[model samples]
Target chain A: MPQIAQLAQTYASQIFWLLIFFGAVYFIVGRGMVPKVLATVEARENQIAADLAAAEAARAAADADEAAWRARENANRAAAQAIIAKAKAEAAAAREARLAAAQAKIDARLAEAEAAIAAARDSALAEIEDVAVEAAQDIVRRLAGAKVTKTAARAAVKEALAHV
Target chain B: MHQFTIEPVVPFQFAGYDLSFTNSAAWMLVTAVVLTIFVAGGLRRELVPGRWQMAVETFTGFIDNMLEANIGKEGRKYVPYVFSLFMFILLANLLGLLPLGVVGIHPFTFTSHFTVTGVLAAISFGIVLVVGFWKHGFHFFSLFVPHGTPAVMVPLIFLIELFSFMIRPFSLALRLFVAMMAGHVLLKVLSGFVINGANAGLGIGALVGLPSFALMIAISALEILVAGIQAYVFALLTSLYINDAEHLH
Candidate 1:
């Protein structure tokens, strides 16, 4: 074979060039470029990790803000409820006082009206008795043609009124 | 065999040596230049890599992972040499199979030469030897004798281990050289049949030439697969051998 025949002649050149070119590849590619590529990958990974951490921090801050807002909302609602309750209580007390005062005034007026009615009935009975006495005396004098005293006529009228 | 002949492109001599710039040396230069361009193109170092960068990264990462698996942390230091070796061989193998013959440029597979492969194997073996001695000193010789050996069987086992260890470089070189040379020879033989059959008669051409042509196509595909497999095998064995040197087991 030519490969075997030419071995003695060509071996030196082949080896020499192989070493030179292979050495070039080793230095240029392996030492020169590989480290840079790996570094880029590592840097990218670190950036991703940092971004994720930042996102987590922002999310936590948002959650804390929401919690604070909820607490404030709850406090304001409680304060409003207390004010409503106080206003309702004050209104109830004021209404109660007004109702009691009006009731006391109505009771006094009702009592005065009752007393006036009683006095008017008493005066009317006394006036009716006097009239009846005078009428009885007149009737006696006209029928018998005798004069009758006021006191005796009043007493007789009283006795007859009583029997009647 | 004429395809395999080495013709000097620029003749030179130094210290009584025929160190001429031959076709083999030219192809070696081509492989180096092409590889450099491929790698340099991918050196954009973008956070998001393009297809070219991805291709380059994939190959480098492949070698890195293989070494990491085989030799652990210390394997990282040998990445450049192994990566250079792998890409060089792989490109040389594939460049040989390029159907550029129609354009009158018959690519030479320099790996088909045993001398070229022998040197590559020697380099790997040399590294193994250097690392073994440098790290473990003379204790590296203890690799020939396995642990828990029967006293009577020690000599025999040592002989066997020593023989196997010694043949590693030869085997490495022979495997790649034979594989590449055989594929090319087969393809050449089949093409010969196709040409001869067609010259002889239409009947023989239809019978032998047609099937051979079809087989040539199939074998060409197999050759491509063999090219990749051979390169991977070389790198893997080298790393495994280095592992032995590093750990001495």
Candidate 2:
């Protein structure tokens, strides 16, 4: 194996330059590079913030749309409920009017029926009185074998009333 | 022909591995200790940061930026490891350049060996591999497989993907080793020439060696830049490997 001394003797000059190379990169990077990266990160963060703000605005808009839809839905429900109540009130009024008219018609029919019954009753009473007078004259003629005078008729009417 | 020579200093074998408590190791130890102290004590944290804190933070921030830019934010996770690696390499390379004529003592640049850098590269690759498996599970292995094609094309695509996936370790190891070794040898040979010329004659050596010295200086500057660049690239690629894991195939 080649000795470390021999190798070092031959290569001393080369070692020197390698050292120079390391120095330049070190100085430049420490001073220049890191700051640039930090700036970029800061810029990125700012952009993210802006994007989030815009997204929040969009979310708020969506919420507003939902609220509007709910409000319209509620209005429709209220309108429908009012219409149903109006319809129900109208139906009730119509039903009450129909019942009142039917009752009036029935009362008029009853009154007409009552008047007809009263006329019939008067005619029947006159017929019954004539029949009764004829019956009484026949019965008296058979019993007495002669016509009854007005005073004797009154005496028999009183005797019949006293026996009843 | 004159013989080339350098005197050996401290040498011993402590562990199973060949150990040389040479100048290189000394400098490496110094670098490690200094860094530990600097981080622990210098950055000993307060409510607000101080100058030392700022310096450490600056280094960390500098490396972090480079990784993010080159490999992207996915690269940031490797920052701690990369930072430590950079510190060690930077200190080693710079120390290697320092005037080490303090008495008879010399300084060593830890980056001289292909094995040293190769191991670092290999370790980095290993980390990438582990992460690939850790993050992606068996699917990372399937990075070798092609997707969204007919069953007829699957075999050919799989072969291609396999080759690409296999090349990562080789590429990583080569890039650092070659750059470091090549640059060092060039500097040394050129410096050797100047020393020879100066010994020959003062006037002629000044005339002849001036350009060599200038070349050495220019090359030195370039090497400094290259050293830092190589470390960054190593860390950057490591992060990319991590990213590959994250993304999978």
Candidate 3:
């Protein structure tokens, strides 16, 4: 019984100290820790926003540079194609002019062959007419028996007609 | 040589000053461990709570409902402190019934001691003092001086009121410790009768023993009731203190 009475005195004191510990924690929470945590969170969020904006600006600049490079590349390609076309046209014109010159030389050779053939026909016809007339006059004189000595017989006939 | 019968080991003391890690402290630590395990187990956050979770929920909800009914909207904010305070007292009281030889000086047992209970009272008083001042500021001082009193009676009223106010923690501590201590002593006294009768003779011993045992059982039951009642009184007073602080009354 005495033991029980004594025990009561002991336990009551322990409860007193626990409350002081809790009170201290409550004060620290209100005064400092909560505000610092909130400030850190706000600062982190703002930093992320700024980084994102800077990244977007850099991307836009890169896109514009790429577009300008592409336009110059396209112009270079078109100029190269035009130069090729012009070189091809010049080659075709040179081929045509060479062909025309070869054809004119061939036509000049054909005209020369025709002129030689016409001259040969005229010389042959004159030689054939002279042979035919000589033969005919020789046969006629052999049949008639009248000796006609060319200029001399003609001169004799003229003198006899004068005397008559 | 006579064989010695050594005294049993009490709670450890340092340089003749016992830290008084009494039965109440042991029980309080046990309650803390139990709460920790229970909370940790249910922390999985399942859609449907398990049996253990449900039990903890019942206790938390019971306190929640109490705060709601007693202090209304402003009461809910005080749930944590009230919860800790109630558990401490409840464990301390229930631990007395443990067969681990608490009534007989074992390492772990609920002891009816003013030191433990008084500490709890002082804590509550401290909280009341600090929170009241913080909430109500200098206006809280007005409670000591009642309104509409005659100038002649003011001095007398103020002294009485101050004494009564000072007694809040003292009375609260005394009330719980006294009831537990007295009840256990009564049980001890009743059990002694049966032992004394057996030494006299079998016939007288059996006659006295049976009834004495029955009386002991009854006292045991009453002790259990006292335990719960004292714990409730402690917790209720804590909440009332909180309420008084909140309202500046």
Candidate 4:
């Protein structure tokens, strides 16, 4: 093979160039560039982690705000309910007081009407007795041509009303 | 044979040694330039990388993972050398297989030459030896003696293990060189059949040329796979060897 035949002649050049080029590759690529790339990877990872942590903090804050808002809303609802119940109880008490005052006035007026009716009835009875006595005396006097006394007639009318 | 021949582009000699700039050397230069451009494009340092940056990271990450797996945390120190070695071989192998011959450019596979592969393997082996001696001193020799051996059999086992250990560089060189050279030779031989049969007659062309052409296509695909696999094997073995040196196991 030409490889073996030319080995003695070509080995030196090949080895020399190989070393020179391989050394260049080692220094330029391996030593210089690799570390930079790895650093970039690490930086990206840290940035992502930081972003995620920030998002988590924001979420927690939002949840806390919602919880506080919910508690305030519940307190306000309870306050409104208590105010409504108090207003309802006050209205009920006022209505009961007004009804009791009206009942008392109605009872007083009914008693006064009954007393006035009793006095009118008593005066009307006395007037009827006087009329009856005058009519009796006038008829007796016209028939016998004599006058009648009012006191005696009144006493006689009273005895007759008692008997009737 | 002509494909394998080395012709000097610029002849030079220094100190009684011929180190002429040859086609092989030119390709090595091309490999370096191409690799530089590839890595340079990825140095944008954007947090969100583009496709080019991603491609570069994929390769570096692959090597990093391999080293971490094989040599543990200490393997981090050898990243530059191992990364360069893997990328150089991988690019050189793939560049050789580029279908540029149609444009009258016959790309040389430098890895096909034993001298180039031998030197690469020597470097890896050298690192292993230096690290082993430096870290463990005389105790590095005990790597040859497996744990829990019979006292009488320890010497024999040690000799055998030493022989295998010494042959590592040679084996590494031979494996890459043979794999590259054999694939190219087979492709060339099959192409010869396709040309010869086509010249002979249409019937012979249909019979021999057609099948050879089909086979060349399949083998070309397989060669691409082999190119990647060989590069990976070289890097993996090197890392494993470094592991042994690091821990002396």
Maximum-TM-score candidate: 4
TM-score of 3: 0.55
lDDT by residue for model 2 (B135-211), tens: 77887867766567788888888888778777777777677656766676787788888988899999878987899
Deviating ranges (above 4 Å) for candidate 2: A1-164, B1-17, B46-48, B66-77, B146-153
User: Tens-digit lDDT track for model 2 on A1-164?
Assistant: 13245665533423333343333333443233334433443455677899899999999999999999999999999999999999999999999999999999999999999999999997886565455555677778899877876466655655664576
Candidates' TM-scores? 0.82, 0.55, 0.55, 0.83
Error of 1 at B115 (Å): 1.4
Candidate 4, lDDT over the whole model: 0.90
Candidate 3 lDDT tens digits, B1-249: 000111223455555444545334445556555544544444443335577655655555666667777777887666666665665566656765655654554423233556656776887898888988888888876677777889999888878987887899999888887887777667767778888988889998999987998999988888888887888888888788677777755
Every model's DockQ: 0.53, 0.01, 0.03, 0.56
Give the per-residue lDDT digits (tens) of candidate 4, residues A89-151: 999999999999998899899899998999898899878888878877787689987776877
Estimate candidate 3's alpha-carbon lDDT, on a 0 to 1 scale.
0.63
Q: In candidate 1, which residue pairs clash?
A: none
lDDT of 3 by residue, A1-164 (tens): 33344444443324433333333322332122223322333354577788899999999999999999899889999998999999999989888888888878877877777777777766664454444344434544788755545455445444543576
Better of 2 and 4 by DockQ: 4
Model 4, runs deviating above 4 Å: A79-164, B139-142, B150-152
**Chain B TM-score by candidate, in order shown:** 0.98, 0.81, 0.81, 0.99
- Candidate 1 docking classification: medium
How big is the positional error of residue B11 in model 3, measured in Å on the Cα after superposition? 8.7
Native interface contacts retained, candidate 4:
0.76
